[model samples]
Target: MASSESSLFSMAGDSYSKYEIRRRNPNPTAAALLVIDMQRHFASIAAPILPALRSTVALCRAAGIPVLFTRHRHRSPADYAMLGEWWSGDLILDGTPAAELLPDIGRDPGDRVVEKSTYSAFAGTGLEEALRGMGVEEVIVTGVMTNLCCETSAREAFVRGFRVFFSTDATATSNKDLHEATLKNMAYGFAYLVDCKRLEAALAPKI
Candidate 1:
């Protein structure tokens, strides 16, 4: 009878472990939408991710959530030191078409625009303060170069104690492998993983 009880306990523990493995995040209370690097140079290359981005933005707008757009802008090699070298002398100078947000997801006066030189949007930008001011507790992150800027921003958000929801279909990278790797890492432990469709549903108005 002791062996039988032990076997039942083991079976129950296995079931509980499996349930834990498949657990999902409780829905976020207040989420800010982060649109990262949807600029001219990267947008065309990130065409696959665009539709999802657009849908997510629209859903967020409809839900009255704040939307923050991040552009990767750098000074010219002659004007800036560290970043110009990092970009191999190419510049994403302010006011250049390359620094402009993609037209499909147009920015409203109410939406915030942030210029960042580094991969992390929160670094060297007012993004953190702005989010805090708006009372944003969760950030829905989406955009180009999944392995670089998007991943970095997501990590920074996590470190800052903001819940991160990374949309898998709304992010891209020049290398497919790198993109997949970032998504896998974020999904495993770094951030909550939701596809655009799921996000849209979450943002939908309840009947």
Candidate 2:
């Protein structure tokens, strides 16, 4: 293939690229913020992005947008067969510190907390129902493991007919390349990509 043809095919495969999805402000009533797998294990490696994550959460709260947090939990060894042998030891056991959300972040008593064992929050959890119950049509996603849990949840949300806004800075992976790759992929086709700062400004109360 000619160089231009190759370039065209490459760009065609990417849906999250800026040239593909022009960034737009989310419609107010349709949007809610979804914080996925922001527990201790992931949060520890994401310490650098803590400030940005916190700010995003606060902005959503102030805007009266529903904020949902997902906690990954799995069964113990005795009951783990149902969850799969591959997850036996790697699971985030219920009530364990590793499964707990970071306390320093904003989490109100009334905020919805959904426990999920799988990568996609909507797979086994009531996250979709909860969002629907609240009349939410758009999801602003942020959290850990940009290429894993976060990306999975965002894609699921999109397939379920919700507009997904994925925060670039509020998510982190074990390596920068994986993180960037996930963002690029999601932003190109799966979700709307926004940095924490832009999202915060968008959610800020009009003066």
* TM-score of each model, in listed order: 0.81, 0.83
Each prediction's Cα lDDT score? 0.71, 0.72
- Per-residue lDDT of 1-207 in model 1, one digit per residue for the tens? 001011110010111121121324324357888999887767455666666678878877788887899888765445455655666635567787777788877478777788888788999798988889888888988886677788999999999999888777777676555666776678676787776566677767779
Judged by lDDT against the true structure, how good is candidate 2?
0.72
In model 1, how large is the Cα lDDT of residue 56?
A: 76
CA lDDT, candidate 1, residue 177: 57
The parts of candidate 2 lying over 4 Å away from their true place are: 1-21, 77-88
Poorest lDDT segment (10 consecutive residues) of candidate 1? 1-10
Candidate 2 pairs with clashing backbones: 15-188, 15-189, 16-187, 16-188, 16-189, 17-188
Error of 2 at 20 (Å): 7.2
Q: lDDT (0-100) at residue 204 of candidate 2? A: 71
